[model samples]
Target: MSKKSKSFFSHFTIAHKITMMYGGIFSLSLLIISFFVLVNVTVIEQNNIKAEMKKTVENIDDYIKNGGELSQETLEALLENKYIEVNVVDVKNHKVYKNSVGKLPSFVRQIQSQPPHGFLDEERNNRSEELEKKGFKVDIAKEFNMDDKAYFISSRDGKEFVLLEKEINFEESCYLVQAFKMLQKNDYYFRSFGLRLFLIDILGIFLSFLIGRYISRKMLKPVEEIQQTAERISIEDLSQRIDTSGPDDEMKELAETFNSMISRLENSFQKQNQFISDASHELRTPISVIQGYANLINRWGKSDPTVLEESIQSILAETEHMSQLIKKLLFLAKSDQNRIPVQKEQFCLNELVKEVVKEMEITTETKRNIIIKEQKTVEIYADSSMIKQLLWIHCENALKYTKQNDSITFHIYEQCEYGCVDVQDNGAGMNEEDVTRIFDRFYRADKSRNKEIPGTGLGLSIAKWIAESNDGKISVESELEKGTIFHNAFPLKKKKNQKYS
Candidate 1:
């Protein structure tokens, strides 16, 4: 087959393919059945013809033995039953009786008049000897043809006419020669039967095709509906959902799965749009502040040292803030895309926590009492730098929220096979709602506090990302005005056994 033909066949609809398959199978099965039936009928008819011919020959033999001549009644009975034509031939190869063509030649009486035991006993012996010498294997009964007429010769009791009786004694031996000719005449029976069977097969094939088409259509109806629903839905219009109402079959499951996928896509698209909008708003503020300060420096701020120094510092601060915000946003984008390269190693959680506390105390101008409590050597498998960053974010948040002289305690220990670090501060804590969304990007607990503190709200979000990338979890516990505690937990690394350290 050519590729074009193959492609054409492949393009056939499911219903067409099913219809063709069903039609082919049904037509083949019907043809096989019809063939067997016709063959069996032919065999049965042939057997019956052979059996009736033998019976008629036997009956004629018995009548002649009782000194009764061949009667018209026997001839009429055989003719009425449509049996084979019969011919009785003597040992001299002379026909004694022929039913269809009337009496035939019989020269036995003239050849030997009262010479031997009966009419043709001597001739019978001579014929048998000749047949055996010629490898004929002469039997008591045999079938032969002469002049297009069939005869059954039977030899019996070594009598004159016993050769005729022996051959025709069994019902299976004798049959009408014209019976084969007559059977040929009824060839129309086969033709008619074949025509009827062909018609039936054609009808059956047509019905099978119809049924297959109907079933395919019914089965694929749900799939077509799903296709239509999907075609109507686009990225801009993801609100369209397939509403399936049926038993929990495969079709119903497919529809439900499709709906679930659409719902996820819609949520992701919404989040992406929101993130872009939030990023624009956050970046716009720093740019506007820098622009305003640049304007101030240009407008007579260059003449005054104080104005020049203040505008320059303010512009630098705002630029730095914008740079930090952009870096955080880029990091989050890489994290979301699963492109963050994490190199994990074994590190002590307690040591990292102590270092972060010391660094915070040195860097900040505030006199807050930072204390390390419950510090222990708890080893964990994670990216050490990312874990340190996570700890610093939490410590910075504590310092930012707390006033000078406020106490912030750091705890590092192992609990339940997990290395845990906790940063607790006596700072302005959050309500239940703020605690819930504390890790959300660009989410500030109090807008007024944000102005006073002058800090980007992306710290906790970045901190959460760092902890999760290191296979750790971050959680917060806080009450309004009672300060807040941020806990980070990681699975403790198992120690490998060694023969020598």
Candidate 2:
């Protein structure tokens, strides 16, 4: 046999625990049902045989009792083919008197110990003793109950008794008796039958397990496909999508969600790469100009104050711009890695907003007014340091983009869903297209705007990252030259003892 077939057979050869559990229950039930059937059949056949024999015995009794004329010649003449033997007894002589082909069984004569009205057994010794003691005659047949020997008894003249024994034999009687004995001998066959039932139950259980495993494997096909699709995705190949057409189950939903996440990740990665490439190219020209102008001053204007002042101021501005760009790039890199682990603590929202507004006033030359239209003493969980950085980006962006004397409003309070912070300005507002990609890295509204501001274009991107990391959102409403509204919304944190009104 093949190895698989041999292994399968080996499993059946050893007893299985489940097989024993279920098989034992089913086998016992089967044995009980079989036993009932066997017992019912045995009882019915025995009853029928006894009923027919009793009928025949009753007929002989009626004939002998009515006439008191029982002779072997008369009995022989009356019963031409009947299976019977008749005997006449002389009570006074203590001997048999009528024609009889067979002698009486000794067991039938030993009847002294029995109640006179009931049947009794008298074997040879007991019969001889009884005959010597009582001077009365008696006769009987050897067997009772079984069909082999049965008889009819009646009295003649109140003293002499007549015994007519029948030899009850038919072709079917022998077969019936043999069958009954076989049934009695092998009465424990049900145990073997229970064993066979156990084997069948074991086979059924094994089949069910095998079929269940096959169905499970077929059902998991979609999941296996999704795993393979995920494995194939890499930095270079982030565009692969899983087939989600099998069924609308959890696996299908997972595949769809995975595809959506991959699309977002691919777009984000592409934007990052474009920003790095553009930033590198844009910085080279200004750096080269600063270096060239410095070398010119060192060669020809060693002691000229005007030349020295001009070169120094120009070099300082270039250095500052470069420093700002480098800082923006580093911040973007940190956000990309999700390295900013937040430190949660309770803090006052109103106080923090005042601190930011006060700090922004010190560094700017523009007459940008800082107005706090709304203030509330709300406490919330946040990383104070990161939140301050996030506030700085928004405040600085509003200040930088607005023209001189543009009033900027900083609203710090609570809304229905979040702790609201709205930074609105009346300056160069963005168009629809620009607002969409404004929070993207190195994305500027116009090339002329970027040149005037000398920005790295990552201010809004870093601000947006901080907001999202803290489970908040940043949005804008703007129109060209009219104004821009930068809304910073943070989800409110529940206080220990304070309840919502």
Q: How do the residues 144-227 of candidate 2 rate in per-residue lDDT, one tens digit apiece?
A: 454333322222323322232332223222000001011122344555655665676567556655654555556666767777
Per-residue CA lDDT of candidate 1, range 185-207, in tens?
Answer: 23677778778877887888788
The global C-alpha lDDT for each of the candidates, from Candidate 1 onward, is 0.70, 0.63
lDDT of 1: 0.70
In terms of TM-score, the best-performing candidate is 1
TM-scores of all candidate predictions against the true structure: 0.68, 0.54
Q: Give the TM-score of candidate 1.
A: 0.68
What candidate 1 gets wrong by more than 4 Å, as runs, is: 1-8, 13-15, 37-190, 303-305, 494-501
Alpha-carbon runs more than 4 Å astray in model 2:
1-234, 247-319, 375-380, 495-501
RMSD to native, candidate 1: 9.5
Count of clashes, each model: 9, 2
